[model samples]
Target: MENTGSFYNRLTLQALAIVEGESDLIANLSNISALLNMELENINWVGFYLLKNDELVLGPFQGKPACVRIPVGKGVCGTAVKDNRVMRIDDVHAFPGHIACDAVSQSEIVIPLNIGEKCIGVLDIDSPDLSRFDQNDEQGLVSFVTELQKVL
Candidate 1:
């Protein structure tokens, strides 16, 4: 099995190449979905939540059923958008006011997808294992989101 840091680095490089090649949002999202689902181990959910109105509307994803609309200040995705910070929770159950979209998800990492100074959406990843996401994961995901902004 690959270490989490190496996994993240590979994902970042893959995303960079894909995003540079595809300029369309839908194509970018589709490739991202496939890459995240296939490349990242231990991930139960890997998707994008676009900010629609006052909530997060589901965009492209590769996983089980996810929450349709997450308020701006609600769950991990919401908090990340509301706070404009990357939210990386080691244990979802231990997180204050965590929304259980997937009971099997023990850990989560949310990266705000930004356009200029404004956030457009969030890249959300969840794992069935506790403490699945680490610092390298956050850094890699943040870089992925930044590349996504330019393409989308």
Candidate 2:
């Protein structure tokens, strides 16, 4: 198996290749979600929640059906968008105000998608294993998001 850094580096490169010259938002997000689902291991859910009218509306996803709408500052996805930062929860059950979209989702990481000073959405990944993500994952995913921002 490849190391985490190498895995993410390849993942980010693939993402860039997929989105290159693709100006359609939905198309880019859809392809990205599929890429993450195919590449990431042990993750039950991987998708995007786009901010709309101060709320998060479910976008393209690669998992079972999820919550359609979430208010800002409410759940992991919401808090990330509200604070304009990444939210990585080792255990979803312990998180106050966590909206359980999937009971099997034990750990989650939410990365807010920002365009300059405004947050447009979030990239949310949920894992069934506890503490499935670490600092390395965070750094890599942040880099992935940074590359994604350039095209968005």
Candidate 3:
């Protein structure tokens, strides 16, 4: 995926435009999940984990069944929210308290979904290959979240 940053950005921006002016959260998330699933390569899963009652609950996703709930400060998705930062785990197995929602998922990226300083959820993507995510992916995904926040 050399030089894919610009392409991804353009694609995500166009995808977001399609959902612009639509105020339904679930509908927007569902479309965004589908867009990621279709656009990203070598990815096993793409989805959202919404924060509810201080816990992460599985939201719109395009993948096999996943864990429904993860406590705040627990697992990759939770940690991203707790830290209010993006997490790109090169090897999920090496990470402490890693949640193995998919046995084939070797690497993962979790981007916190926030409204101002308050985290409301995460955009979680997993891959079957190790070291699948890097700083570039983090930056691109962060931009994706920024666009998403506008519609949220």
Scored by lDDT, the top model is 2
Q: Please say which candidate is ahead in lDDT: 1 or 3.
A: 3
lDDT (CA) per prediction: 0.86, 0.96, 0.91
lDDT of 2 by residue, 16-121 (tens): 9999998999999999999999999999999999999989999999999999999999999999998999999999999999999999999999999988878999
Give candidate 3 regions above 4 Å deviation.
none
Q: Report how far residue 22 has shifted in candidate 3, in Å.
A: 0.8
- Regions of model 2 farther than 4 Å from truth: none
User: TM-score per candidate, in order?
Assistant: 0.90, 0.98, 0.95
Error of 2 at 105 (Å): 0.5
Question: Clashing residue pairs, candidate 2?
Answer: none
RMSD in order of candidates? 1.8, 0.7, 1.3
On a 0 to 100 scale, what is the lDDT of residue 76 in model 3?
Answer: 94
Clashing pairs in 3: none
Give the C-alpha miss distance for residue 13 in model 2, angstroms.
0.5
